[model samples]
Target: MQDAAEPPPLRSRRDLVKELSLGMVAFGADARNLTSQGNLTPAQTRRLLPAGLVAAIGGELVASMAYLAMGRWAYASAALVRQLVEVEYLAWAVTNDPDDAWEWLKSDRQTRLQRWQPGKIRQRSDGRFPNSDYHAHCEAGGHPVPEPAMNILDHRDQWVELSLYEAAVHGTATWHYLVQAVGDAPVTAAERHHRLIDEAHNVWRRTETLDRGFLSPANGSDA
Candidate 1:
């Protein structure tokens, strides 16, 4: 049973902006540091980071816009998945079910999200969503959502989380490239990004309880 004291789901654009902003800032700072270690001058490093940061920002913006479209169209299944997946992504740091994400992306983007709804739509005045209500609404329709790492299990009876892993992988890869570009074998940028990725990985592992008693995964501890 869920505690009545549980806070409502953050369902506002402002919340999205805040979360995305923090992630972008963290990512952008790392990007800048990596670039600064390269053959490029400070000016080039600055320019490179702004561009890369824009792409990262664009990704978040596009995702938010998609959620907005989902809400407007009352595509409850799609909307809920988008929202939940995003939340889980933020928590876990990797893409959840790349196959599913691909499927959503391949669907008709322009008109598919604006379809109709037949049920009574309830609105939250304070913009808070109770966990029970969210679970009820999101899972009632057999929506093929990816198993959440902290809360759900996958087909192999494994806790499947990906977003944090993806972020860590991205950060690590970028760090390597940046290290190579900067021509520094003992640079701090590489180590810092590596540490960030390690932090993200630790979060993922803890969320899944892999180090506790969970088992049957090669990526996790033998607990």
Candidate 2:
């Protein structure tokens, strides 16, 4: 029998984008919708989480390559691409951690919010973190044990939400300019894209550490 033919090679981010397109189709109708929403259905989350993670990385590469290839610049698309990376990382990180991580991801708010005192979640008379849901237990970043990162994770998740919102604003503004300009202006876009790449890399590493039990008793991070 003849030997099997060699597999094709990935030549560029454009190629990766095609690969992502395949992975994204696995998400069915909600693939595009889920990218912007705060919460995902359990079924959608299960199918899209891995694809989202890969998509984020692939998007970054595409943005970088496109930015560098440009003689001028495109700022808005670049920023959107970067923000997307952080957003995907946050989703993936939270979904993979915590006992009820999926439920956490399903929340309109990705983290538990409450007043924290010392190392515990403090109840408030003002009814803060309204309609309290998840317990105060978060381990993302380098937060040690006996600490109320439930509050912190809530804050971080909020920030990610806000960042993406701002990104959408800028993106809308730039898309108009990009259309008028015939193509994108690459200088500003490249700058923002590169910066976000660094930030995304750091966030991924930090979250991955948490996923590996960075705060566990065996890790010497437990307080």
Candidate 3:
């Protein structure tokens, strides 16, 4: 019998993009097939979660590579990228609400508020976070956790959410501009990176949509 063939070595971000996108597509198909017949087996659920995580990671990597291609010359572009990062971080700060995060992304208002005073989530008269509980809990505790001097949402989950969000925004924005900014780079290199970033972003977007569409309702159904 012939030996199994070896897989090709990945050479660039583009390659990673292709791999990640393909994986997500496959996973989604499987998930749908399984759901249609019956619920996923425990093992399948475990596998799916990891694949979703991987897709999310790929999205961040793609965005980062794009920004890196732009180099220091794209200062305005870079700042915009940074703004994306900040918004993502703030998203986590406010809890993983994409709606709230995207809302802040559209305006500098939240950033300005955050920038001016750390952990300052604007609240309504009822004293609830406009959308989050980050500050409310901290404030209401009888022995209030001394607000960390710097970033307010400093907990591990909060930090990870912030970090992931920043990475996603920076990576996506960078990927979008990489081609224009790095045209001077070798053609093949540019194209590869661009494709990688695009693929990564697409995978992330699809995965997120799937998660929101499927998981949220499923959770509600359980409740």
Candidate 4:
């Protein structure tokens, strides 16, 4: 028996990865079942963009876990950036008129770029950014926005999130490359295992928020 004062042993990294993988698989299945419940009309089918975005997020999460297992932290970080993009896409889908959102999603790069060009993106009176302001948009749409949506849209840590995402995708930060070179050497195996567990928990939390806010029966019907 272990001493009462001692901390419990950490689970293996493989176990952590397996747990995360299983959770994602379950989420994917749930999303599929949710989307397949009833025959959708043509307009409804077009509005399935948020469901597609949720699936995209699941793919990014699985890719992130794969990269982490392969000791490719930078690639994993880049996957995280893609996941954030999916979240933004989901927000855009739920908040706007479905037809307009679908048109924008299917628009060519040049057309999309023209809409998002400098001076075109306006800040609202509530201090929220255009198109991605979940709180404001949800209120306007008479939908209840989830806490995660508000948390992310509040922009309190906007700079930090933006910097990390930019560094991961653009290789702008030296540590991004340096950490990949160093691999997991900076921490003990147990420490690394715990880190993986923490990362998995964060991903699950975000996934739950997305499911509840945009993919549940009540909310998904609107999409």
Candidate 2 Cα outliers beyond 4 Å, as residue runs:
1-11, 28-73, 98-100, 109-223
lDDT of 4 by residue, 21-97 (tens): 34333433443443466554555445543334433354345445444434433223333443333343433333444
Best by TM-score: 4
Q: Give stretches of model 1 more than 4 Å off.
A: 1-24, 30-171, 184-191, 199-223
Select the stronger candidate by lDDT from 3 and 4.
4
Candidate 3 weakest ten by summed lDDT: 213-222
RMSD to the native, candidate 4? Answer: 17.3
Model 2 is weakest, by summed lDDT over 10 consecutive residues, at 128-137
Reference-based TM-score of each model: 0.25, 0.27, 0.29, 0.36
**Number of the top lDDT candidate:** 4
Q: Roughly what TM-score does model 4 have, to 2 decimal places?
A: 0.36
Worst 10 residues of 1 by lDDT: 116-125
lDDT of 3 by residue, 1-223 (tens): 2223422221223343344334333333443444345455544343333332323443444344344433422222222333333332332332333334334434476665654232443331234323232222222121223432122233333222222333344344433332232222222433444555566555455333123210123312111
Q: After superposition, how far is residue 170 of candidate 1 from its true place, in Å?
A: 4.5
- Give a tens-digit lDDT track for model 1, residues 134-154: 343244222544442213333
* lDDT, candidate 2, 1-223, per-residue tens: 2223422211222233332323222222233455346465555454344433434444444444334323222222223344333333333333333223343335453244421221222132133221221121123222243333343234443323322322322222222222222112122332333344344333333322122112234323333
Number of backbone collisions per candidate, in order?
9, 7, 3, 0
